[model samples]
Target: MAFAVSGYEGGKTVDFRRLAHTGIRLVGITRSYRDGVLSFEEGLAKNVADGDQAYFDVLREADAYIEENGLPFPPEPGAWELLPDPDCLTNPILSLDLAAAGITTIIWATGFKFDFGWLKVNAFDEKGDPFHKRGISAESGIYFLGLPNLVNRASSFIYGVWHDAKYIADHIVLQEGYMSYAKP
Candidate 1:
């Protein structure tokens, strides 16, 4: 998804392989849609393959984040402790699970599932739909255009992206210094 946007805006073709190089990982999760929503859990328990060391080398870029991010280096083998918060707890399983999963970032290319639960904003209304003023969001680089009555009633339709795409693409071009979002 990022590659697609970057390519369209940059006027240069990019590949998904860049995802791994950029400290992002992907896993396809099994899911079913019902009533215009997608639902899945990380605990669904499926086989997610791990990448080679070459791919994981991208994580070294985050090494400086160990102390600042509070994700310290892995404890010595067979060493384990759990801290409870305010009592702060450290479960080695958390890191071990991530390492075993080989997933630094998982991008699900599912469309229109309207599942932004991972977003850290209170962008939802009482009914859980995006509470944006029109399609704009308070969160940086985030916007919601295709939802019922988002901008206008038609903003959720196929034509919505046509209108909003230009805005988003223009923003991407400016922010990322890409050429254009025009389709070749």
Candidate 2:
């Protein structure tokens, strides 16, 4: 029940086993095919076990990380328990209908908030949050950095911060046509 990566609480490890005992399941969404459109549907079961190429690739990388970091995970069974038949694994999506399950309330505890009250522009969505493509606002020179999913899921991470900074720098240079801007 251990997660491969957990970065909650400013670097504190949570007891997921205890959480699981309380019927708290840690789950992730299966990658959806957008066909060039950015969209995802609730409970979309598009990927499963061995048929999911992305899953296999990520599993391989996680295994490598676990080994390199000398994690306590057992090597024999490894990080994931793969069954002989893919069908044996329960469907990634357990239930999609929350109302049917007697669900009357949902509390979104997403531990992130945005305060863009200072930015006066039309680069915002109905939710009052700045909507941009890879941090580039619709308005010129108004770029957002270190936002969640701004460039990808890791955009707020330290590694992502540096990567995004470089991307924004390059984008500014290209947009402004700064021929003297040197790249190291």
Candidate 3:
């Protein structure tokens, strides 16, 4: 059967037509006229047809990594358990226990968060807020990097990480004046 599908912008339409001529049937246009909606089925179909096994392989590898690292859900749960410094403290219970055990200098590298629900301050909006325009949180002596919209709207890209890193370094330096570094 012959079909004339439309609405796809750019080279995708041409690519689809070329692929269709090669025995691939143009069943239907997948995308919607509305914005922000993605067509997963169509994307999957295209990936399968194109023999793009790399995508699925990466997903499988990520799943395996999560499983092996005891991060069955969020994909990297216990991956951070073995910190490079191993001096940083995370869990409050563990921190208290360690404190009781006479350990000091609990370095917390729990990473960044998009949600600010823990903060009782007005730093958050009606919804939990981003740390900065990027995705930093409001914990004292804490720094964040690699967040979306750190500098510009599109600062989430790899190029923008430098900007975020610089900001974090500056903040760390400034925090040194008010923050004391001693063993707990």
C-alpha TM-score for every candidate: 0.29, 0.45, 0.30
Q: For model 3, which pairs clash?
A: 88-107, 89-107, 131-136
Clashes of each: 8, 0, 3
TM-score of candidate 1 versus the correct structure, residues matched by position: 0.29
Q: Against the true structure, candidate 2 has what lDDT?
A: 0.57
Q: Evaluated with TM-score, which candidate comes out highest?
A: 2
Model 1 has an lDDT value of 0.45
Candidate 2 per-residue lDDT over residues 1-184, each given as its tens digit: 1122357666433433334446654333423423332223333223332234444565688789998998988654533443332221223343345545565665756355688888888888998988888788898778888886677646877766887888989999887676555544
Off by over 4 Å in 3: 1-124, 131-137, 180-184
Question: Where does candidate 2 clash, by residue pair?
Answer: none
lDDT of 1 at 120: 74
Write the number of the candidate with greater lDDT, choosing between 1 and 2. 2
Candidate 3 residue lDDT tens string, 1-184:
1111234663121233345446543332333323333221223333323433443344577788878888748644442221121111111111123344464563545234465466565445456654444434565544445555466433555645777777677777777755665424
Q: Is candidate 1 or candidate 2 better by TM-score?
A: 2
lDDT of 1 by residue, 144-171 (tens): 7666645443456675556765666666
Scored by lDDT, the top model is 2
